[model samples]
Target: MSIFSKIKQTLHLMKDIDLDALGKLSQKVDLSEIMKTVGELDDRQLAGLMKMLKHKGGKKGQHKLPPIDGDFYDMALKLSPQQRELQIKVRNFMEDEIKPIANEYWNKAEFPFQIIPKMAELNICGLTYKGYGTPDENYVMEGIIAMELARVDVSISTFFGVHSGLAMGSIYICGSEEQKQEWLPKMAKMELIGAFGLTEPEVGSAVAGGLGTTCRQEGDEWVLNGQKKWIGNATFADVTIIWARDEASDQVKGFLVRKGNPGFVAEKIENKMALRTVQNALITMTDCRVPESDRLQKCDSFKDTAKVLRMTRAGVAWQAVGCARGAYEAALKYTKKREQFGKPIASYQLVQNHLVEMVANLTAMQTLCFRLSELQDEGLLTDEHASLAKVFCSMRTRDVVSQAREVMGGNGILLQYDVARFVADAEAIYSYEGTKEINTLIVGRAITGYSAFV
Candidate 1:
């Protein structure tokens, strides 16, 4: 018989079978011709076919598995309907737009500048900030957005955090009203991108005491001199918030250093194993003259700088949660698909044990961060609250991603598998914002009144 005739016959037989049953049977049956013939069926015939699909199983048409999502706690449901929609919008954007090209851009260590406008359309920059075109969302929404963004690509999240949380946050928290009015609006719109320069070549954890970078008052202008290392987004940032110790006052101050300023130079840091797409710059400032007005007006000391860090550090912890969730979800899906011996590897006890362990840690981290964001929204959050979460979540994420990589076996290390990127990115998350040792000490100080971060 012709292919159409064969398909018609098959559809006739399948008309009484459950759709799920038909699906499973179709996998084993040579139904190609039947499928072709069914394509030619009229609407009534198709409806009849669907009706037939309803009776092949017990009571239900077919037993299909639930969606294999990693949000085990249904945290997304906690968001407002609008917030949840925004979450899905970002998730769709990441899957459709970023995932396809993530490995390529990561391998080349190049930022995908083309997606900037697309990101701008999300209206997420300065997510929690008020005024100046910002969203004025709550801290939880901000954390959720950061988590969603990092779930697909940590580099993009880092780039955005530097711009919205660190750079603009510095202006928002420490800049004078005039400065905020001048900069926050343009930045909120992404018309101007920003960077934060704080860590120095010679000093990192010790930055608060004194940085090698120095700003000397020179009458109408301040001459900045020193180098900043690992300054994210600085390579092409329109404005960099350079933090340096004032030579006379011995206090750290913030300067709005414009791009292409004659005395400022930024070279991309290369060969980074983590967050390669972040465009970290080793910045050198030699007699860079910035106007006094450019000085962060309300920033009297390093205390002001710490205010911004305290705020963004919570978001970093949320990013760690995303990294863990992404890895765990990838590994779980891989286990279900990858076959070994006579059946799927997920059926193996050892593999299931690993999956359980990953989920346990991931769940704990998620719960911790959720509460942290809640405390922040309630205005009860402190540096120790954020530091504790950062230290714990980042540390736990390292373990989770490692197990995720382990579960994938050889494919775990392959970039195409997706878990490898999370593996590499976890290392950077562990070290940045605050190292485990440092953040732990901060929490230690808060709890026991002892400072060990000397």
Candidate 2:
């Protein structure tokens, strides 16, 4: 038969098929001009059309698969569509750009500096702050972004959080207007990275009330001398916000210590097991001279520093959620693809139970972070509020990642499996912002109306 005649015959056969059925089926197909051409079908053509539609539907149904997400609470969906889009954008960036390179960088204990420019394009630095080239987004968006970043790699998130949230937030909240205009914009643009040097070698949680680092004022310069340990991004940051006890006033004051300052040196803290990708530094400030103008104006005591910690601690909680999610998703995907006894292990009851527990923990963490963010947005978030979320989420995340590693057996330890990285990164998160003991004490103080952190 001629080609045109065959086409005409096919059209004639389709005539008897219900156009409505064909139209409904057409929605599933990607064919061009399908509805316009449906009018020309005959009975036999319609039978053939129905057969094709059924086959297509069957194939589509067979190919349809559940999303491989660990967010059992649909936390991302809770965001406004714009926030959700931003979340997906960050996820894609992490998956496409960070995931492939994360293990390599983590193994080498090095930060991927090249990704900074790409990250800058996301326009999310200092995300919750107003002005200073910042996004000025809500706390929920900030928490979601932090979770998205850490979900792929916690080390990267920690580095970013230390720079953008802790250091920059300190300057924003306590610095003079001149200081904010001078530093916040550049830091917001990622041109100048920042670090917080609050924890001393001798003081960890006790630094708030009794910091060993002391700053003595002489003339127009403040002389700072002390040792700070586990200062994230300190080795490469442009400025380090050094919180020290002012010898004259007996109050903690923040000083912006510039990089390459005389008597200021940050040695890389080597042999770290967790968040190895972060370049934590042990900094010694021996007579480090900071100009009086560099002092954070409103930061008269430890209370101001605590405010910045309160804000960033919530972000750390979200980071824990991300870490748990990364491990859970990795384990879920592995179980589905990995076979045991000639069948996918995901079908096994024990494996399913492990996944169920991981999901349960993950869902609970997400919901808690969502509410935490809500409190933050309402300007009602307290140190205790953030501490509760941080303590709970980080502890749960450690459990989730442990289970994730457990289900994968020996393969879980391998960096290529992705769970191993989350496993390691979770440890750093648990310790960095505030250790579980410290955070719990904060909550304890709030609930009991007494300070227990000493």
Candidate 3:
């Protein structure tokens, strides 16, 4: 109503306007003409204009940003609509089903058997294999599924990887047509859970050259002897792919050892600090008899074993990405909500520095794995390529989870915070599949002409 009141109100509204933006707008519109037009407005019209400007161009704009996603490069946008749906489907399943009970089962050192049926419903097992009831998706989709599962629970991801990638993969890659038809379809349907037995007590990284488990062929049967350590899902897996050295040939051979074999025993390895929910077993085979038909016909040597590892190793790299992503996201969300010195800890320069480093490493790992999957789909992926990704992603994931713990302070060690679990799981991931030293040597041998593994 009054000119003075309108002038004062305009000044107050101007305080909220972004002056730089207004200056840019001035280049398009004549400021003097705009002022002349505004001068004629009554108090009500002035108030309405102020509200509109504040809503649109105020210092704190009215726009609400979507939540920060860990996939910083928007790689999911590259997925086909069908692949994208599957990715979201798996993510939601992990968040809704596994996340709630992750800590509980993890703390108790028990696998959640109830989830098997529900997880089977996802129909994601044997993801890359073309037949035997597989979905025939690309390797990228397979990697995304692995990342999604590990993002929520590394233990569950490991379980799935063992069954889907290693066990089913051995059959798909090395089994005879009859063997694949008999086993892969049921395993894909989750009717027959599978496990992989490769690592031995006396041999780990050096398993390629020194497999202690021995397989001796008899009449239409092979008798297996010696032990397998850290065999995931072995305790209850319907079938375990046992890799043993042929006593006659000295080359490695894989056998499909069914559960309930008279001489096969799987004792749960307990008291693990990492991946506690995974039921890793120390397996012993004493004269275990497997029929010749049960042997993976194509797997006559260690190179066949390496074939499976090369494929699964890439998935492990993606799992590392998920583990880091889960930790980084948890840390970022925690720092934002957590206050120190009367403001959010995330507002502090040092805290932001750590977050920036974590995100940078996370982004690098994601992009690298994406390209690695592309190579896989293109059939250009090699043992060294998978080894490089496994080494880099696993090593970086340790740093990311460590930073997550450091930012959380005292709460970092507490399992309830979620970051602690990732911190512990990172250790296991670093060692399993292949140690950093082993993987580094693989890359070393690839780039250089000489081998330094000895």
Candidate 4:
């Protein structure tokens, strides 16, 4: 190789070094003399110099970063011993059982059905629900559990939410005593898996005002006909809470549609980019006949369904905190270890800015969700409170995950690193339960004393 060629190659390599640090170094060192030495170097010597520049940028450095934690405010310290134990238990289950296979199963877009019984043993299902074989824990504990589940894997947390929060919650809040007796026990035991089906193919944000599914009271039954989309756990749930508008009353009602009740068909939704481990199903109910006894008698209108939503929406906010917490922690660890210019990238001011922003957003979300759950437990949680939490947390979670991905650079898109999945899953969380626009308007209506919902 020509001597001139080696110098050119060395100059190209110098571009990647931290320019600000390099400028400082130039003031302390004789760069012109260094170039004079470099121009005179033999080919082998130049090659060695280039290697040093590539790996260490011609400098040696060491750094010590504190242990990575997303809970900047130590929010967990407020938890009771039992609540903390429950949180650790869920976190261990996720890190031990789920984290190992999360990416692979997510790549295949399939649920790990084997974990269902194992998860059931936690006895955390329906934790906040009172009576009928429940731990009857507070809403704060339930929110913590949701956060722990999502911290490791968002999809599993989502599956649990659809069952424990939505389906069982429907039976708890809107079902008759007989209906609860028949479903809640087996469901609490995880013997009867459940799904909540309210979203329709053509309606989402407008579902409250315009549910496409309809049902009519027959002689001894109700015949339901419509399609529901993006229903989590619908494929294998033992029973589904199907909400449909009644033809006569024109109000929404809930029914326990058993898996194979004549015409209920659930096809797996494919090619999803987010929450792939969840078995979301596109349901087609063609004159699906459900017995009158299976109906949720207390579900008199969409207002009743709103009750279920208001309860679970707070939980969704907690899940958003988990998602953001996971992403921020991952990025923090990566930045601490990932090196540039012979030092951890986290040492750089700009990179620290990104990490700080992520944790700031995460901490804000955690404190907000804490209060949101407290309100829920105190029976002071209103639709606007839940909606505000959902809005702020879900929106901020996106920002945190985006920064998590950005700090990782190209590797952020690869699922092997886990941040990629968080990034993708955050998108789903942002859109589900309620979108930002819809939830914002809910809060707007409450404060302004006027409905802005279109």
Ranking by lDDT: 3, 4, 1, 2
Candidate 2 global TM-score: 0.87
Residue 47 lDDT (model 1): 47
- The residue ranges of model 4 lying beyond 4 angstroms of the native Cα positions read 1-64
Residue 392 lDDT in candidate 2: 97
Q: What are the lDDT figures for the candidates, one per model?
A: 0.88, 0.87, 0.91, 0.89
TM-score of each: 0.86, 0.87, 0.86, 0.85
Q: Report the lDDT tens digits of candidate 4 across residue range 160-224.
A: 99999999999999999988888998899899999999998899999888689999999999999
Which run of 10 residues does model 1 get worst, by summed lDDT?
1-10
* Regions of model 2 farther than 4 Å from truth: 1-64, 450-454
Q: Let me know the TM-score candidate 4 reaches against the reference structure.
A: 0.85
Candidate 3, residues 1-26: lDDT per residue as tens digits? 44544554455547646799788999
* Cα lDDT of model 2 by residue, 225-276, tens digit: 9899999999999999999999988999999999999989999999988898
lDDT, model 2, position 251? 96
210-296: candidate 1 lDDT, tens digit per residue: 889999998879999999999999999999999999989999899999989989999999999999999999999988999999999
Ranking by TM-score: 2, 1, 3, 4
